[model samples]
Target: MLHYPAATPSDPVDASDDAPEAGLLPRYLARIGYKGPVAPTLDVLAALQAAHIAAIPFEAIDALTGAAIDIGADAVDAKLIGGRRGGYCFEQNGLFLRVLQAIGFEAEGLLGRVRWMLPDDAPPTPRTHMVVRVMLAGRPWLADVGFGAAVPPQPLAMDSEEAQPTRHESYRIVRHGDVWQVAALIEAEWRTLYRLDSVPPPAIDYELGNWYTSAHPDSHFRHQLIAARTTAEARYGLRDNRLTTRLVDGRSDRRYLTADEIERVLSEIFLLPVRPHWRPAIERAATAEIVG
Candidate 1:
């Protein structure tokens, strides 16, 4: 696990009503299909988060294809906004943080260690997840759109341990000393999602984490096909060749696709433009392990 810098007295979170990067705000709003007010209120934040998840997909095609994942501002804008590609945590949350800041929200970047799908006795994982911390009227709320399969559809309150309802599932944040463990309710039981540290990380941490996740041989993203997107009615997640649609009423439908069908699904279901060179990697991923 990579050690992150400790939290200091510096305030990295900022709000600017007339942000110089405001030129990108219009295009971002259009990409998400959001036509709401651009204020820094809770309503705008929740709407933007939901809209983003619905419009943009969570994917790892670059990693699967052995391509270097760039987390810089210009690269992120070109790939996610200008191009028809989706990205993992660092790119997703990095773009989201910029959008929020451009809209005059007081937001900061956060780091987390993924505990999702890990066994109870499993060793601690690395800090690879990226999330956003937003302060609205002095109350802190967690905003994240990068978690592939079970992303929170709405912003979660950080100070509460009660079950917070979202579009698909209910999530809660439980404090463990200085760390906060986030959980999602599934099959009537709460399951661990990830453990987040409150300290705001430096920008360089994202570049390092992105490289490790996309380039490391041990990283599952390089070996599997992970894609996800949510809608008003259901959340769709694709692992390897199997696609699962989880509805809001607690019902789910799963289907396994053939290698030949991967491209169609990637384009039609996930809304990602299928590239010709990605076919080889897609074929390998279709035959890889089904469970991660």
Candidate 2:
């Protein structure tokens, strides 16, 4: 069974309030060097999605560094503006939601569970993801800019099987019985990305799920470090201390790095803010795994 909470509208802002029309969004986008137009239309959504994918990356470094993942808007703003780095789902989606609102799109936050890329019989682990619901031209669509490798910028129709084109890939949603599934086209084949029911989810509904994803024993991020970005032909990721780049041409390259080298690569290549606490945490987790 699936559960969702009601939408809680963010505090209202007066039109006369001169609190920077661009708000923290344009600056955050600028920090990541995203130079794009900001009109709220289908074409603009596509452009923004492309700019977002090319600039701000999906990452989990902060959670590994001992920083709390607060999904609140102000906290997210502080982290992006104050820390000058990227964040995982909570942070990225929180910030992206505000940007969508500022850009004149009607948007709301939604939550989802992640069913790993295995058999359909495997139970889904609920609250593993966060997404946004955007209303455009009287249609409700899904907008996610923080799904790490699954980020899709253009708002996708909530209940359609039409192929929506984005800069990164073409996406579609299908319904099987009561369950809805998201898929991405790769090599001319449809690949299941994840699935969710038509349940409305609220912000607080995700707190527990977020906590578990960051702290649970079996959580992938708890024991490994992963950061990835999509390029024209391949997806590059740092997995558990190894850097693996998968090319669209079906070539894969893996490299092992020392602790110091990992730190350097994370900061320099992945654009992560390497903190002192990260090394010990990664070491402890790796050591525990080795002994187990």
Candidate 3:
């Protein structure tokens, strides 16, 4: 179930005032480097999505570092805006949804089950992923900017089966019964990304999902460090001290980094500010598999 946030007609705050203050819109725009029209048009939607993807590094370092996390836009601002940092799905997409509404897009929040690692025939994964559905020109498009490295750079038509091309890859959403399966073309093969039902998720549902994803013993984010960011040319990622880059032409390169390079990747590539106390733990985490 897709859920529309509370409203008081046209007021950006009313749309999704999850942020502590209504004035966060301008900061959000500037942070993403968007200075174009805010009209509810495909151009604006595409531009915003692409700009956000380029500007934000989808990382779980804060969670791994024991920093506080909340889905509130205020927390997003505190963590990402000036910190030169990033967050996982809830923090990223929650902030993105508020930005869309503040700008005039008719946007709603939804949740998805990540099938990225599960076989098609395996039991459905939990609804742990967050997505935004925006209605523009009477058509609904899926605008997801928080799914990490393999994410598309623009909004995609939800009802169309045709592949939508982006700077890094081509993506398509296929429908089966009441479920929608999102897929991306990678290395000449189509890979399922995630799945969503017609039902929209409420805020409490997100809180529960966030608990499992952030604190559960088996959650991937609770372990070693992982971060990634994309540009028009290549995808850069940090999995511990291993740096991997995949170019637009399907060319790929991988190498392990020295301790100094690891710090640089955390600071420069991921655009994150490293705290002194967290550095030693982070360095050791680079090669160790953390377990509860």
Best by lDDT: 1
lDDT rank order: 1, 3, 2
In order of appearance, the predictions have TM-scores of: 0.92, 0.79, 0.88
Candidate 2's TM-score: 0.79
Write the number of the candidate with greater TM-score, choosing between 2 and 3: 3
| Candidate 1: residue 85 lDDT (0-100) | 80
TM-score for candidate 3: 0.88
Error of 1 at 185 (Å): 0.6
Q: How close is candidate 1 to the true structure, as a TM-score?
A: 0.92
**Residue range 113-221, candidate 2, lDDT tens digits:** 6754556677766667777777788887777777766566456787678887654468888877856678887668777766765665765677777788777768777
Q: Per-residue alpha-carbon lDDT of model 3 for 1-292, expressed as tens digits?
A: 1221221223233325664346776677778776666556777678778778778889887667666578776677888786767888898888888778876789988888998856779986778899999987788899998888777777888989989887678999998988888999987888999987777777899998888788877777877678888876888877777788999888999888766777888788777787787687567755664232
Leading candidate by TM-score: 1
List per-prediction Cα lDDT, in the order shown.
Answer: 0.85, 0.66, 0.78
Across 1-292, the per-residue lDDT of candidate 1 in tens digits comes to: 1121232332222234555564577767768877766768787788788889998999999998888888988898889888968888899999999888876789999999898988757898888999999998889899999998799888899999999877688899999887889999988888899999989988778777887899988898988888999987999998888989998887899988888788888999899989999999888867866644
